[model samples]
Target chain A: MVLRRFLPALPPLLAFAGILAIWELLSLYFGLDGLPPPSVALRQVPVILTDPQSLFDIVDSLRRMAIGIVLALVFAIPVGLWMGRSRFAAAFFNPLLSVIYPVPKAALMPIIMLWLGVGDASKILVIFLGVTLPLIYHSYQGSRAVEEKLLWSAAAMGMQPPARLARIVLPAALPEILVGCRTALVLGLITMVTSEMIARQTGIGNLVFQSLEMGIYDTVYAMIVIIGALGFILDVLFERLRGWLVGWAEPAQSIIVGST
Target chain B: MIRFRQKQRSFTFERGFRLERGLALAFAIAASTAGLTAASAQTIPTIRVGWTVPAEDAKYWMMKRPQEFPNLGKKYNVEWVQFQGTAQMVQAMAAGALDCSTQGVLSLAQGAASAGLQTYIVAQHVGEKAPESFSVYWAVKDDSPIKSVKDFKGKTIGLNVLGTGIWGPLAIALKKNGIDPDKDVKLVEAAFPTQEDAIRTGRLDVGVLNQPFAARAEAKGGLRKVFAISEEIPDIVHILEACSKTFVDKNPELAALYVQDLTAGMGKALANRDETLKIVTEIFKAPVAVFDPFYFKTRASSDAPLGSADFARDPGAAANYDGIQKMFKLYYDVGMLPKQLDVKDFKHAKIFAPLKP
Candidate 1:
C-alpha cells in the first residue's frame, strides 16, 4: 500500500527533473546565448525569496487576483443565474455576451489605459473581462440544468419561488458552477500577471519584464518559478475548497454531481 | 408573323446569354485575386521605415507620419512601424518584415555579423550631440559616494538594455576607467523616463542617459553627472540608418531618395536650430519654454563647465563617415561586434551612398 501511494508521486517528480535536465542541456549547447541555464536561474531563487520586495510581489499579485475574481463573480453569477431562469434576462444579455466574448479583450488595453491611467483599476477591469465570460456561461448552463421535478417538489412543500431556487436549483447546479470556477481560477491568475505586465508598475509580472529588459535573465526565470509555484498552490487550494463545499452532495466522492 | 415572333424570342435569349457572361467574368476575377495582388505588389514601391523612437532618437522628420513620405511622396508610397529597441528591429528584419530601420552600429553589426542578416548601413548621425557637445552621461544622486567611473566598482549602474547603443560605449568607458563590466559593477536596465526617479530614490547608484534627459535631470536639482561617455568615446557616430539587402536590390532609386531626403532633412535641421526646435515642440506637444534656450544643450560630468565655443554653425558635422568607422573599430575591439565584421562590410558602397551636401 505504501509503495503504491509513493509510486504515483514519483512520476511528477521525474517529469520535473527531466524538464530541468533538458533546459540545462539546451542553455549550454542549443539555446540562445543570453538565456541562463536552469542551474543558474534556480540559484537566484534564494536571493529573490529573501528579498522583502519579492515577498511583496507575491502578496500584491494575490490581492489583485482576489479583487478581480470577486468582481467577476459578483457581476457574472447573478446575471448568469437570472438568464438561466428568466427568458427576458437571456434575451437581454446573451446577444451582448456573444458579441463581446469573441473579441480579444487584451487588445482593448490601450483605450482602457487611456481612461483609467495605468493603475490598479485598469488592470483589475481587464482581469474581470478575461475570466467573467466563461463564469457566466457555465453558471447559466448549471442553473438551466436544474430539473423541473426538483422545482415542483419544492413548490409542493409550499416553498416560494426564491426559496426553491436557493435550496434546490443553486445547490443541485453547483457541480457545473464549481467547474466554471475552476477554469476562471486559472484564467484569473493568468490575467492578473498579464495586466500587471501591460500597465502597472508593480507585481511579479512587472518584475519579470523589468528584469528581462535589464538583461537579468536569471532573475526572470526565478520569478517564473515563484509564479508557477503560486499557481500550483492556488489551484490545489481551489480543488480542496470545492471538495469541502460540495462533499454532502456526493456521498461517494466530492462535488455536486450534475444529474439534476 | 412567325419570323417576327422568332426574332423577339432570339432577343430575349441574347439578353440572358449576356447576363451569364457577366456573372462568369465576376467569378473569374474573384478567383484570381491572390495572383493579382502578387502582381500589384511589384508595380508600386512602398517604403516601410522602422525606428525605435526615443526623445533623443526621434525620427519625426521622416514625413511619413499620416501617409506619404514628405519629399518622395509622388515616387514612392510609405508605411511606418515603430519599435522599442534594436533587438526588435533585428527580429523584424530577420522575419523579412522590416525594409529599412535606423539603429546604432553596435546593433547593426550584431544583426549583420552575428546573426548573418544581409543588411547595409546607408546613413549616419551623431544624435543630439555636436562634436564639442557631451551627449551620453552617467548620473548619480546628490550625495552618492560614486564620484567617477572608478567609484562605480561594486555599485549598481543603470542601463537601457544590453547589446545596444548605450551598453557598447558604457563597456568601453568602464574598461578605460579600470573597471570590468562583467564583475566590477552591477547593472540595472530601466526606461529613460523612469531613470530620474530611480536615481533620486537611490534605486540606482548611477543612471546612463542622453540629452535632453541628462540635461533635464540636472535641471531638476538633486542629480549630478558621474561621468560622460563622450569623455571616453568622443565623436562616435550615434545612429546608423540600415536597410535590408532585399529592399535595396528591389528598389534602388527609392532607397537612394529615402536616404537623400533624410540627409537633406537633417542638414536643414542642423543649420536652422530655431525651426528644428519649433518642429520638436510641435511633435512633443509642448510649449517653447520647456526646452533649453539653445538646441545643443551640453552638461559636464565633473564640476567644471562644458567646453564649448558657444556653438559653431556646422551643418555637415553629423555626416562624418570617418567618425562612424572609428566607432565601428572601437565596438569590434571591445567584442561588441562579431570578430568577422570588417569596417568595409558595414559600408555598402554600391547603394544609397549618402550625399553630405
Candidate 2:
C-alpha cells in the first residue's frame, strides 16, 4: 500500500533528477564560468536553509502570492457568478473584461504602483490583476454551462433563486473554477517575481538581481531553483485540492483505434 | 566620335557573356580581399567600452563624434556596449566581457564590493568641486512643510535604488545629519523619473534625484531642493572612467592614452557651452531647451576642470595617494563598499595621465 501510494510520485522525481544530470553535463561540457552545476546548488542548500533573511524572503514572496490569489478569488467569484447568471450583468461586464483581460497586466505596472503605492500592495495587486481575469472568465463559463434541465427541475421543486445558486450553480461550477484557479496559481508566481523586481527590492527577484550584480551567479541560479521548487510544491498542493474539489470531473479517455 | 559610339553601343550576346564572366572574376577577387581584410581586423583586440543607458555617459558620447576624441579610433578599434545599469557593467567587467566604462562612483564601489571584480578606475569624470561637480539633490514637494533631513525622522523617502549613484551619497549625507540611515526614515525604491510623481502624490516625503532628471523635476515647478549631495562631501568625485585590470596590466600605455583621449573630448564640453549642448542634444536625443537649466546650473558652478588635477595621473605619480585613500575611505564609511578594500590594492593611477590641452 505504501509502495502504491509512493509510485505516483516516481516519474516527477526521476524527471527532476534527469534535469539535474543534464545541467551538470552542460556545466562541464561548456566550461561555463559563473554558472555552477547541480552539485554547487546542493552545496549551497545548507547555506540557503540556514540564513534567516533568505528564508524570510522566500516566505514573504509566497505570502504575497497567496494573498494576491485569495484577493482575486474573493473579488472575482461573486461578480463572475452575477455575470454568468444575469444578462444585464454579463452585458455590462463581458465587454469590459474582454478589453482589459487581453491587456498584459505587467504593462500596467507604473499605473498600478501609482494607485497602490509601492511595497506589497503594488506587487500583490499586479498578481491579483493577472489572476482575476481567468478566474472570472472560467467561473462565468462554468456557471453559464450548468444544465437548463436541472434548473427547470429545481424550479419545479420550488427552489428559490439563492437556493438554486448555492446548491445547484456553485457545485456544478466547481470543476471549471478549479481549472481557472490552477491557471491563476501559475500566473501568480510569475507576476510575483515580476512585481518584486519592479516595485520592491526584497524578494527572490531582489536576490537574483543583486546576486548577478555581485557576480554571485551561483546564488542567482540557486534562487531560481528555490522559485522552481516552490512552484512545484504549490502545483502539487493545488492539484490535490483540485482532485478533492472536483473528483466527478474526470476526463474521458480517448478510444483506441488501430488493429486492437 | 567613333570611340564614344562604341562605348554607348549595346552589347551583343557573345560579348555580354564574356564581359559578365570577366566582371564576376574581378568581383570575386575584390570580395575575397575585403573578407580577408575584415577577418584580419577581427584579430585586432577591441577596447569594448560600456556606457549606461538614458544618457549621462558624456565621455562615451564624446567618443561617438570625432569632435570628442580625435584619435580614439586610431589607438583602439573601439566598440561601445550599452548597459541598463552599473551592476550590469560591473558584471561585464568581472566576466572580462567589457574593457572600460565611465562608471559612477557608486557602481565603481559596487565593482570593488564584488570579490571577483577585475576593474580599476583610470581617471575621474568629475572632481568634488561645486559647479563642475555632479549634482545630486534631495527634494520635497513644494507644499511640503518638511524642511530638511531632520523633518524626515518618521517620513517616507524615495530612493532610485539602495546601491546606486543616488543612494551612495544620499545614505552618507542622511547619516551625517544625525538621522540613522536605515531606521529613521522609510525608504521606497522607485525609478528617478517616477519619484517626482510619488512626491507629488504625497506617497514620498523626500526624493533623491540625479542630474538631468532632477533638472526636469525642478522645471516641473512643484519640487524644491532641500540639500545637495556634493555639498555634503566636497571632495567626493562623482564618476570615473574605469578599465579592466587585465586591459591596464597588459597595455599600460594604452590605458593612459585612453584617459587622455577621453579628457580631450570631455574637456571640449567643459569649455564650450553652445557647441557642447548641440552635441549633448544629439547624443541624448533630447532638446536643447531641456538642457538649458542643466547647462545654466553647470555654468553657474564655474568650476569645470576638464582634467582632474586632484589625483595622480598614474599610481606611479603617487604624490597624492592620500587623497585617493580618502575617497576610498569615504565610500567604505558610507557602507557603499561591502569589502574593506585597501586603496593601494586597486589604485594604480600612474599608468593613466590626463591628456594635456
Candidate 3:
C-alpha cells in the first residue's frame, strides 16, 4: 500500500524535527549564561554566508586539505602497495608505523610549530601526517587483497610485465585503493581543523576557536555548522563520483566509500 | 489484468526500499537520542579551573601543599589545569574548562565581555612604566631604522594575540600617533614567547616585549622601547582574578576562600618583592628582573572581604571596582568587547560573606 511506502520515510523526518524542536527549547531555556539562543544561531547562517571572510576561511580550509590529501595519496599508495605486496617491505616498515600511528598528531603540534615556524607548511604537514598512516594501512590491505588468479592469468598470457600490472593488478585493486583515498581525505580534513584549532592563526578552526575564546558561542556553533555541512556535501560528492567510477562492483565494495 | 498481477507479484522492491528507509530512520533517531543523553551525562557537578601560572607557582594551592591549601581535598574537588600562555589559558576558560583564572586585564576584559561571562574583579596588580608588562620582546637587527612607534607605520610588527593583550593597546597607541593600526602596519601575530626568534632574523621592525624578554632583547641588540600600554594608558595593565557566575553560584564559599588565599598570597608576594621575584622567576623560568618592575605593592589585609564590600570600603584598594570598570570601558571603546555591556551587571559580590572582614 502507499501508506506502507510512506511510513518508512516518516521516522527519520520526525526524529530530526524532534531534534530541532529540543534544540530550540534548550536555546530558549538552558542558555549558557549569556549566550544567544538557537534562533540567533540560525540567523547567523545568512550572516556567515553574506560575509566574504567566512567564505575565505572555508576556501582556505579546503585548499589546505586538498594539498595535504594530494601529498598523502602520492606517498601512501605506491609505498603501501610495495610494502603490502612484498613481505620484506612490510616487515621493515610495519613496526615503524605501528609504533607511531597511535601517537596523537595534535601532541606534536608545538614541535612542528618550532621546526616549521607555525606557517602553512607546518599545518599542511600535520594534516599530511594525520592522513598518511590510515591511507597507507588501507592501501596496503587493498593491495594484499588483489586476486592472485588475475595476476597468474596475466603472467600466463605472456603480457609485458608493466602491461600485466597495468592491465591486471591495478584495476583489480582500484576499488580498494579508492577506499584508502576516501579515508585519507576524511582524515586530512579532521587534521586540518584540529591543526588550525590547536595553533595557527587562520581557517575554520581558528574562526571557531576565536569565537569560543571571545564567548561568541553563536559564531562558534555557526562555524561548526559550516564545517559539518561542508563535510556532508563533500561526502555526497565523493559518493556520486564513486558510483560513477565503480558502480559495477558489488554494493559492499562501495560501502567504505559511502561511509566516508 | 494489471491489478491482478500487482496483487500477485511480490512487493520485493517496495519491501527493500522500506527496509532501507526504516534502517536510516532508526539510525537517525538513535544517534540523536544517544548524542543528547551522552552530552547530558558528561555534565559534572564540579567546575573546572585552569591557570597559566606554572605548577610550581600554583603549588601552594595543590594538595601537595596541604597546609597552604586546605581547600583542595574532596570537599571542593577543584580541578586545576595549567597552560603556557594567557591566550591558551583564556581559550580554555571560554571552552568552560576553566571557571576562573588570572590574566592581563586587557585580554581578560575582552574575553569576558565577548563570552558573556560575568567578570568580577578579585584583585589587580600594577607594573612599572615599562614598554612591556608580561610579554616577550621583539627586536630588529642593530641597523634597522625603526626607532619608535612613529617609525612603525610602514613596517612589520610582531604582536601577541591581537584582541587580548598588546594588539589592542598597540592599536590604540598607533591610532593616537596618526598611524592606522591595520592599513599602515603589517601586524604579525606570533606566540609571545617565539617573537624573539622572529625579530632576530630582521622580520619585524618593532617587536612587542614584556619585561625579561625586553631585557633580553636589549642585551641582544640594544633596542629602543617604542611604547608601553601601561605607560601610554596608565593602569591599563591590571591582573584580573575572574570567574564565571555559574561557578560563583555553585561554589560561593569555595570561591570566597579562593579569593582570600590568592589575595593573601599576593600580599605576601608584594611585601617580599625580592623573594617573590625569585619565586615568580623560577615559576616562569624567566629572569628575576622580568618580574621585578611589574610586581605591584600587595596590601596585607586579611580583613578585606571578597567582592564589592572590600572594594566599596577601599575604593582605591588593590582590586577596586571603579578602576577596573574604567579599564573595561577602555577595552570597549577600542572595539574589543562585542557590544557595550554595562560593567555593573558583571559584578557579583559575595567576597564579604565568607570572610569576617
What CA RMSD would candidate 1 show? 22.3
Top DockQ hit: 3
Pairs of residues clashing in candidate 1: none
Cα lDDT of model 2 by residue, B1-357, tens digit = 112112222212233234235336535654553343242446445677766433333463454465456556665666664444666566556656667875666566667776467666666654444545445667888888988767778888888776565565667767777888778888888766556667776778888766556666655577777866666665555556678888889987777766666656555555666776786654443457656665523333345321111211222211133445665667778776776666566667565435442
Candidate 3: segments with Cα more than 4 A from true spot: A1-136, A139-260, B1-47, B53-66, B87-91, B125-144, B271-320, B352-357
Tell me how each candidate scores on DockQ against the true complex. Answer: 0.01, 0.01, 0.02
Q: lDDT per model, in order?
A: 0.65, 0.65, 0.58
Encode model 3's per-residue lDDT on A55-154: one tens digit a residue: 7777777767776776676687677777767899899999999998998896776667556644467778888899899878876887788777766776
What is chain B's TM-score across the candidates, in the order shown?
0.76, 0.75, 0.67
User: What's the candidate order when arranged by decreasing DockQ?
Assistant: 3, 1, 2
* lDDT at residue B332 of model 1 (Cα atoms): 82
Compose the digit string of candidate 1's lDDT tens values, residues B1-357. 112111111112123333345336535644453233242344467786766433322245554232324555566655655444666567567666668876776777777777787876776544434445655678888798888778888998888675556676678878888999999989888776557667876788988765445545555567777776666766666666788888888877777777766666656666555766676654432345445443554433334433221122224323446666777777788877766455566556655434431
Instruction: Say which docking band candidate 2 falls in.
Output: incorrect
Chain A: TM-score in each candidate?
0.89, 0.85, 0.85
Error of 1 at A53 (Å): 39
TM-score for each model:
0.52, 0.48, 0.48
DockQ of 2: 0.01
- How far out, in Å, is residue B55 in model 1? 5.9
User: Which candidate, 1 or 3, has the higher TM-score?
Assistant: 1
- Which 10-residue span in candidate 1 chain B carries the lowest summed lDDT? B1-10
Candidate 3 is graded, for docking, as: incorrect
Reference contacts preserved by each model: 0.00, 0.00, 0.00
